[model samples]
Target: MATATYPPPPPFYRLYKDYNENPKSIPEHPPPIEGTYMCFSGNYTTDDVLPSLEEQGVRQLYPKEPNVDFKKELGSLNRELQLHILELADVLVERPSQYARRVEDISLVFKNLHHLLNSLRPHQARATLIHVLELQTQRRKQAVDDIKSGEKSCRNFSWSLSEP
Candidate 1:
């Protein structure tokens, strides 16, 4: 009787095991704080630097600027920034850079951004669903290739030896 040989473990098995063992091992960054603040001691007024400062969570500390509209500006700026990142992600996925050694990293970035957008805009659930489906399709193709390679190795081994 002959025993069937199994293929070696996949590269991602270690990652899967680590994830399953400690799902919370990844540290989460805090949500962005929105505030307006002064930049320089020159002629530039606080208003001149408020928008950029608020985007980075540096709001005015003085009571005189009590009416500062940081929240509104931050909301708009956050949305715009998110959209910009999404556009850049799309381009990267479409034509990955030759210097990128790990294409999966880029894919994960897109996946996270898609999730972020979905959470921010529940109305776009359908579009998010489509994006996830596409990612899954790509993963499926990679899995199929692995299986095919394993099968070829088994076939070659079986044909090379004589009956015992």
Candidate 2:
């Protein structure tokens, strides 16, 4: 194969050389290159950067699901919670020493449950708030009872309460 040679590269004129050579070559006012800076700097409008929740096929928690029954769902969740609490109580009855460790797990489960409840129905977020209040009341009662019975120290009984 014969060796191929490329032609000389085009010359790059100094600042405004072309403009000086031919004043009319460059328009007095060039059209703005829309978003040229933004494109170069990786900056994009909200629509360009992130697809809306609706566009992403994410159904809105509220009005989108018109057929959703909030009362029924909440009732079911309440039942499940009752069952879990009963199970946790049974575990505590079986092993009194496991209170501290078991309570942490129960707290985490409730946190997730509260998140689910809020996400499913923002209008019904009050349910989670009420539930959290109930939990706090229950925990406070338990702590007081433990303190009265001298089973656990009031000083050592540290409860992390979250307001939903």
Q: Which candidate number maximizes TM-score? A: 2
Candidate 1 has a TM-score of 0.26
Q: What is the lDDT of residue 16 in candidate 2?
A: 50
Model 2's alpha-carbon lDDT is: 0.61
Residues 1-164 of candidate 1 have per-residue lDDT tens digits of: 97659877887556556566788764566665455534585443333232333354443222224353544544544665566566667767786573253443444444433433433454366779999999999999999999999999989889877546
Per-prediction count of colliding residue pairs?
3, 0
lDDT against the true structure, per candidate, is 0.55, 0.61
Candidate 2 lDDT over residue span 1-164, tens digit each: 86559865556444356786788775356675655357666865533233334664443332335465756655665675677688779878898776775676556446545544655664557779999999999999999987787744533444323323
Report the Cα RMSD per candidate: 22.3, 25.2
Residue 19 in candidate 2, Cα distance off native in Å: 52
Clashing pairs in 2: none
Q: In model 2, which regions exceed 4 Å deviation? A: 1-68, 99-105, 120-164
Q: What is the alpha-carbon RMSD of candidate 2 to the true structure?
A: 25.2
Give residue 131's lDDT in candidate 1 (0 to 100).
Answer: 92
Best by lDDT: 2
Model 2: residue 83 alpha-carbon error in angstroms = 1.7
